[model samples]
Structure formats: C-alpha cells, structure tokens
Target: MTRVCFELRIKPELLDEYVARHSPVWPEMLAEIAAAGRRNYSLFVAEGGRLIGYYETDDDTAAQAYLTASPIAARWEAEMSRFFVGLEARPDEAATPLTEIFHLADQLAAASTTSAEGDAL
Candidate 1:
C-alpha cells in the first residue's frame, strides 16, 4: 500500500469548530472513504492551525477519483470549504502529497548498527 500524507492550514479562529466538526464524522463519509480504498486514515491538528492527514491506499489517484465522484464528498467539501486556507480546490481535491525526506525505520537500523559496533569496541 502507498502511504499518503498531506497538509493544509485551517483558519485560526475556526480551529476548535473545525475539530468539532470532525469529531463525529458522518457514517456515510467513513463508508465512502473505505469504499474508495483508503485505509488507516487519520487527521491531526496542531496549535498553529496546521492540519495533517495520512492514509494508506493501493492507488492514490484512483482513491481520490472515487472520493471526488461521491455525492457525500460534494456536500462535505462544501461544508468544509470555509474553514481552510490556501486550497487549490475543495478540501477533498486539494491534497498535495508530501515527499518523505526520511523514515524512522532506517534511522533505527543505523542506530542499532552503531550500538553494536560500540559494544564490540
């Protein structure tokens, strides 16, 4: 599965409301996300209006296409559009995939090797 991560900023004043809106996501929306092949979906927010989202999917483009075509997606996007900034399109369509610069597993392996060498010394 391809892991996808994306980010956007919310309006500072609406951060709490934005979080509240997501607290109880509509059941249909969750169903649609599953149907679109998005697995392990999650969203995180920080104090400075930063929102990060991640998901695992076999095909990012196809998953996004499925989301864009859903009627529930249209309604959800319309409702959510007001709370964000710097969106290229609707929230559903505006995700810009982030390029991963590093991964923790590789660092952990390096650390283990260094520790092993030190033990041999």
Candidate 2:
C-alpha cells in the first residue's frame, strides 16, 4: 500500500468549527472514502491550525480519481473549503502529499535482509 501524507492550514479562528464538523463526518462521505480504496485514514491538527492528514491506498491515483468523481466527496469538499487558507482548488485536490523520509518497518526489513546475507556469508 502507498502511504500518503499531506499538509494544509486552517483559519485559526475556524479551527473549532472545523474540528466539530469532522467529529462525525457524513456517512456517505465516509463510505465514499472507503470505496476509493483509502484505509487507515486520519487527520491531525497542530497549534495555529496546521493540519496533517494521512492514509494508505493501494493505488493513490485511482483513489484520487474515485474521490474526485464522487458527488458525495464533492459536497463534502465544498463544505470544507471554507475552513482552509490559501487553497485555490478544492481541499482534496489541493492536498499535495508530503514526501516520506522514513518508515520504521522498511528500515527493519532492510536490516533483516542484511543480517540474513551476513549469516549466509
């Protein structure tokens, strides 16, 4: 699975309402996300309304396409657009993924391979 992480900033004054809105995302929206092949999705908000989001998908492009074509997702994004800052496009479309620097599982798997090679040597 591809792990996707993205960052966006919310208007600090609207942070509370933003959080409240997500307390229970629309059921149709949630269903659409799962149908888009995104799993383990989560969002985090830091001080000053910095928002970080993460999710795993088997095919990021396909997932994005599915969500983009979904009417439910469109409605959700339209409502959420007001809480963001400096985004010219819909929030979902504007969520440029952050580059991944490290992952513990990958490093551990590499270490195991090296150790096994040494044992065979």
Candidate 3:
C-alpha cells in the first residue's frame, strides 16, 4: 500500500463549487480509479487555497495510466481545470510525490521506537 500526496492550487472563490462537484464524484471515474487499484482516496483544503489530495495505490504506474486513458477522468479533469492553476495541460501533468517521514496508527498498541542518539540507542 503506497500512499501518495500532492497539492493543487485552487481559486478561493471556486472552492465551494469544487466541493459541490466532488460531493458525489462520477461513478465511472470512481470505477476507473478502483480498476486501477487506487484506494482510500481523499482530498482536503487548507488556508491560502491549497488543495491536498491523498490516496493509496498498489501500483502507481497502473493507476496513472488508467487515469490518463479513461475518457471520463480526462473529461472531469478538463472540466475542473477551470478551478485550478497550472492545469492547462492537466491529465498530462504529473502529481508530485510527498516524502513520508513518520506514521502512527491506532492498531499499534506500542509505538515503534527509533534511535534518536544516532547509533541504535
């Protein structure tokens, strides 16, 4: 389960409309994502009109190829491009990968320890 995260700059005024459009994402688009092995997808908005999207995928290449080849996804991207910047050639534009430093989960009763003294201390 590889997790991916990226940011998109959205127009502040279009935030509401963007949320509304995504309230019930197109079934076909969801199907395409699932078909491509994408799971646990989510999006969030932060101050300064930054949109953060996250998802877990088994194969990034497959997921990306599926998205690029799916007509529904392509159309959706084009439609939503208006609400974002740097999306002029989107669907072709690649999403940047974020580095993962640490993760905490409720399933772990005891936290995993890490050496802080720089020598397995």
Candidate 4:
C-alpha cells in the first residue's frame, strides 16, 4: 500500500459545516471511496482553515483516476468545492499531494533503546 497526503484550504466560516458533514460521512460516498481502492482515509483540520487529508491506497494513480471518473465523485466535489479555496478546477482534480520527509515508528523505538541501555550501564 502507498500513503498519500494532500493539503487544501477551507473557508474559515465553513469549517464547522465541513466538520459536521464529515462527522457522518454519507454511506454511499464511503462505499464509492472504498470501491475506488482507498483505505484508512482521514482528514484533519487546523485553525485558519488548513485542511490535511491522508489515505492508503494500493495504487494512487488508479485510485484517484477511478474516483475522479465516477459520477458520484462529481456530485461530491460540487458540494465540497463550496467549502474550499484555491482550486484550479474541482476538489477531486485539484489535489496536489505533499512529499513525505520521514517516517519514525521502528526508527524511534530503536534509537530510544540505545539511550535506555546506556543509562543502565
């Protein structure tokens, strides 16, 4: 699986609405997302309307293409675009993912062991 991350800006005033809408994602939309090959998807928001999205997919290109080509995606994007800013076209087509700099699960555990063992010695 591949990890994907993207950043977008939401309207400050619409943040509550945005969050509310996602609180109970539409069953059909969720189903479409899954059918498009996305898994473990999540979205995070920060003050001033910064939005971050993350997901794991078997193939990012295929997943995105599948979603964007679907009529459900078009409908969803039309509703969601009202809450966003700086999109060239629509939410579905405008996403530009960020490059991953580092990942530290095993690395952190291994590095911490050296410090813990040295303290005992």
Candidate 5:
C-alpha cells in the first residue's frame, strides 16, 4: 500500500466549522472514499489552521481517478472548498502529496535484514 500525506491551510475563522463538519462526515462520502480504494485516512489540524491529511491506498492514481469521477466526492469537495485557503481547485483535487522522509517500520525492516545477513556471515 502507498501512504499519502498532503498539507493545506484552512481559513482561521472557519477552522472550527471545518472540524465540526468532519466530526461526522457524510455516509455516502465515506463509502465513496472506500470505493476509491483509500483506507486508514485521517486529518490533523494545528492552531494556526494548518491541515495535514493522510491515507493509504494500493494505487494512488486509480484511487484519485475514482474519486475525481465520483458524484459524492464532487459534492463533498464543493462543500469543503470554502473552508480552505488559496486553493484554485477543489480541495481533494488540489491536494499535493507531501514527501515522506522517514517511516519507523521501513527502517526496522532494513535493520532486521542487515542483522540476519550478519548472522550468516
């Protein structure tokens, strides 16, 4: 699975409303996300309105394409766009993935492989 992360800024004045809106995302929107192949999704917000989102998918391209074509996703994004700052496109479509610098699980797996190799030597 590919882990994806993105950053966006929410309007400071609308941050509370944004969080409240997500407290219970629409059921159809949630189902559309699942149908698009995204899982383990989460969103984090900071005091300054910085928003970070993360999700994992087997194929990011396909997942994105699926969501781009989904009517539920379209409605959700349209409703959500107002809360975001400086986005010319829908929030979902505007999400540019953040680079992953580190992952503990990957490093641990590498360490295990190196140790096993040393044991054989």
Candidate 6:
C-alpha cells in the first residue's frame, strides 16, 4: 500500500459549509474513489484552515486516472473551488503533493501498549 498525503488551504469562513457538505459525501464520488484503488482515506483540519488529506492506495496511477476521468470529481472540484484560493486559479485545481518523511504507526502503537502496561504496574 502506498500512502499519500497533501495539504490544502480553505477559507476559514467556509469551513462550516464545507464540513456540512462532507457529512454526506456524494455517493458517486465515494464510488469513484474506491474504483481508483484508494483505501483508508481521511482528512484532518489544522489551524488556519489548513486541510490535510491522506489515503492509502494500491495503485496511485490507476487512482489518479479514475479521479481525473470522473464527472462527479470534476463537478465537485468546480463547486469546491469557491472555498479554496490557490486551486481556483491553478490549471488543475488540485493541491500539490507533500513529501512524507516518517510514518510511525506501528511504533506508536507499541509505545502506547508499553505505557499502558507500566501504568497498570
């Protein structure tokens, strides 16, 4: 599985609306994502309206092709551009990918288990 992560900025004032819309994401959009070989997708919001999106995919190229060919994705991007800045003016209307230095999920889980055991003693 390949892990992907990226950051994008959204207008603070539009956060509420954005969250509401995402509460029940379009079915077709979800289907498109799945068809693209993406899994365990998640998004996190940070200070200053920065949005961090992460996902694991078996085939990144296939996922990209699926997304680019999806009509639902295109429409969603157009609607979402209103709440984004750089994307609105960019040719692709998509966020740039970020480099990942470290991912320590297993190590963190082991540390948490160790801490719990110590607390019980």
TM-scores for candidates 1 onward, in order: 0.83, 0.98, 0.79, 0.83, 0.98, 0.78
Off by over 4 Å in 6: 88-93, 105-121
Q: State the lDDT of candidate 2 residue by residue for 3-118, as single tens digits.
A: 99999999999999999999899999999999999999999999999999999999999999999999999999999999999999999999768999999999999999999999
For model 5, the local distance difference test gives 0.95
Model 6: per-residue Cα lDDT at residue 115: 100
lDDT of 5 at 3: 96
TM-score of 2: 0.98
Q: Is candidate 3 or candidate 6 better by TM-score?
A: 3
Instruction: Give me the runs in candidate 5 sitting further than 4 Å from their true place.
Output: none
What TM-score does model 3 achieve against the real structure? 0.79
Please tell me which model should have the higher TM-score, number 1 or number 2. 2
- Indicate whether candidate 4 or candidate 6 has the larger lDDT: 4
By lDDT, who's the top model here?
2
* Lowest summed lDDT window (length 10), candidate 2: 88-97
Sort the candidates on TM-score, descending order. 2, 5, 4, 1, 3, 6
For model 2, give the RMSD to the true fold.
0.5
Cα lDDT of model 3 by residue, 53-116, tens digit? 8889888888888888888888988888888865657732544456876666622433333333
lDDT of 4: 0.89
lDDT (Cα, 0-100) at 111 in candidate 2: 99
Summed over model 3, clashes come to 0
Off by over 4 Å in 1: 105-121
lDDT of 1: 0.90
Where's the lowest-lDDT run of ten residues in candidate 4? Answer: 101-110
Error in Å for residue 35 of model 1: 0.5
The TM-score obtained by model 1 is 0.83
Highest-scoring model, TM-score: 2
